[model samples]
Target: MHRPLPTFRVNGAAIRTIRMSAGLSTSETAERAGISRRYLNHLENGYRDRMRPGRYAALRTALGLNPDDQRLLARLPHEEPD
Candidate 1:
């Protein structure tokens, strides 16, 4: 069954939590995710809400998110775009 993509949300806190749990620093995660450190920092600090779809996919891959984790993230409340 094809699952519809969940409503887009800004779960920066969740991302930061997961990153910390994985023992990766912002720089490390950014490098691994093929994104800039500044961008990662913005996400972690909740300065930014939405990232490009490609970047979001890269982040999920970089974070090594399991299926359940992915679901949890999907369900997080959406943030208003700035």
Candidate 2:
């Protein structure tokens, strides 16, 4: 049996706040996170509410989130494997 994929519910506003506080631009953060700027923009604008666990972790790392902030932003759930 395949393991379920980890899904994360992200907080767009919180991400934008953290990025702005860190003095990082969308392009910079996206580059650091290895995601496209448009995708990051979608995330920041709340267009996308769900993300894979790996992507969420990369975004958190790119934003340099503190432990508390990371915990606040991360909500992971498992999805059944196809």
Candidate 3:
């Protein structure tokens, strides 16, 4: 059977964490990442799916995230450990 494609369900907490680490306002980050402030807010609120790849790359890069973080952001959020 074909393998399933990985989902893109970035957790809002992760987004907020990275943003805070970078000491960036949502508007500033959104502008730098080439996304709208409204869209970024939605992403941070966990109400959106599938961020634009370029924009996602921009956010991760601007946040100074390493490869693992980049990889993690590209996939769906993990379930809480049971």
Q: Which candidate is the best by lDDT?
A: 2
RMSD of 3: 4.3
Question: What's model 2's lDDT at 77?
Answer: 56
Worst 10 residues of 2 by lDDT: 71-80
Tens digits of per-residue lDDT, candidate 2, 1-82, equal 9997877777788788888999999999999999999999998898987789788878888888744565425344553244
Show model 1 residue runs off by greater than 4 Å.
1-7, 71-82
Alpha-carbon lDDT, every model: 0.75, 0.81, 0.71
Query: Roughly what TM-score does model 2 have, to 2 decimal places?
Result: 0.76
Candidate RMSDs in Å, in order, are 7.0, 6.8, 4.3
Clashing pairs in 2: none
1 or 2: which has the higher TM-score? 2
Off by over 4 Å in 3: 1-7, 71-80
Clashes of 1: 0
Position 55, candidate 3: lDDT: 68
**Which residue pairs collide, candidate 3?**
none
**Estimated TM-score per prediction?**
0.71, 0.76, 0.70
> Residue 54 lDDT in model 3?
64
lDDT of 3 by residue, 1-82 (tens): 9986544556677888878877999999888877888988888887785665566677777667764675325343474544
Residues 30-60 of candidate 1: C-alpha lDDT, one tens digit per residue: 9999999999888878788777666887787
